[model samples]
Target: MSAYTIRDATEADVPAIARVYEHAVLHGTATYELVPPPEAEMLTRFRAISGDGYPYIVAEDADGTLLGYAYGSAFRTRPAYRWSVEDSVYLEPSAQGRGIGLALLLRLVELCGELGFRQMIAVIGGGEHRPSIRIHEKAGFRHLGVMEASGFKFGRWIDTVLMQLPLGEGRDTLPDEATYPGTLFRG
Candidate 1:
């Protein structure tokens, strides 16, 4: 097993998180973003996600170096979407293929379930991006479909792959409004 620990992310992890995401924005199809957001922008995003009671987590090795991070966010802004969350996971280049991303994703799923979310959605950026698709599959996400040529990046069209996983009891039971995630209004 890898000697790494997964834990909730903190504001202090923003800089490292930004760096990891910057690399992806520049070189990878995992995200359709063309320009890397500044560190301040990253910090603002972190505040929005974590402050909203969503799950944001990081993985660190024994020496305490951050290898990757993952988080869940509201699938959409509407009240009806409150029970679903969109999952995001990113790894520092060196951390690829080390089981860290899957670990972070599984932890994100677990945390989202704890937060009363019923569905976890992964909109992977590229249809050809098998690594990400495989990771989500390994995390038990079911393939929904691919949105062909939904994104233009690197001067070419990229397809988005959609996958989903049920969280907790899913739709087997209804959520009590008072205990639903903060994205929804309490009863």
Candidate 2:
């Protein structure tokens, strides 16, 4: 087992997080965005994710270097979708294939279950991303389906696969207020 620690991300982690995300956007297909999000925007999104009780986690070494991060966010804005959430996980290139992704994902699931979410979804970039698929499958996520050619990136159409894991059981209706939570969602 690698010696790494997982914890809630702090404002101090934004730069490292942004660097990780920028690396993905510029060099990998993990995210479909063609341009790196501005630091302010990233900070706003990070703040929103943490402020509303949505988990934003980071994995770090004993010396405090970031290795990976994962988080659970609202899947959609409709009140009916309140119990469903979308999860994202990213690791530093140097940390890939070292079990860091699995650890972060497992912890995200545990935290989401504790926060009362009933379903978790991962919108994977492609069906052949075996590492990502394996992590979700090993964590009990089922293959929901794939949206073929749903995204255009890098001058080509990219397929997106959806994986799901039910986190909790109970509750058939929303509360009287029924207002959707601002949990990593912009609406």
Candidate 3:
């Protein structure tokens, strides 16, 4: 097993997180974004998700070097979609093929469940991206479907694969007002 620790992310971690994401955006198809967002933009995004009570976490090795980061965000801006969250995970090149991605994803699922999220979605960028698909599958996510040619990155068309995992109670029960995800949207 890898000797890595996973913990809640802080403002101090944004720079490393941004670096990891920038690498993905530039060299990998995991994200469709062509231009890497600056650290300041990443910090704003982190604050938004953290402010909404969503979980954002980072993983580090025994030496305390950041290996990767993951987080859950509202699937959509609409209130009806509040109970569903979309997850994103990015890792450093040196950290790939280790168990860090799975560790981070499982923790994200656990935290989202505790926050009363009904569903967790993984929007895998390319249909050919098996590593991401495998990680989500190992984390209890099911293959939802795929949108072919949904994105054009790296001068080629890419397919987007959607996977989903049901969180606490999922949609089997209606959420009480206190547990409703829309509560975050309320003024």
Q: What is the C-alpha RMSD of each candidate to the true structure, in Å?
A: 1.4, 2.8, 1.2
Predicted candidate 1 versus true structure: per-residue lDDT over 11-79, tens digit per residue: 999999999999999999998889999999999999988878888999998988889999998889888
Q: Is candidate 1 or candidate 2 better by TM-score?
A: 1
Candidate 1 matches the true fold with a TM-score of 0.96
TM-score against native, each model: 0.96, 0.90, 0.96
- Model 2: runs farther than 4 Å from truth? 170-187
* Span of 10 residues, lowest total lDDT, candidate 1: 178-187
Error of 3 at 14 (Å): 0.7
What range of 10 consecutive residues in model 2 has the weakest lDDT sum?
A: 173-182
- Tens digit of lDDT per residue, candidate 2, span 1-187? 4699999999889989999999989877788888999888889989987887688999999899999899888788666787788999999999999999999999999988777787898999866678999999999999989999988887888889998988756355433333333443334
Candidate 3 local lDDT, 36-148, one digit each (tens)? 99999999999988888788999999988899999988888888788899999999999999989999999999988988899999999999999999999999999999999
Candidate 1, residue 38: lDDT: 99
Which ranges in model 3 have alpha carbons more than 4 Å from their true place? 181-183
Please say which candidate is ahead in TM-score: 2 or 3: 3
Tell me, by lDDT, which candidate is best. Answer: 3
For candidate 2, the TM-score is: 0.90
Clashing pairs for predicted structure model 2, backbone only: none
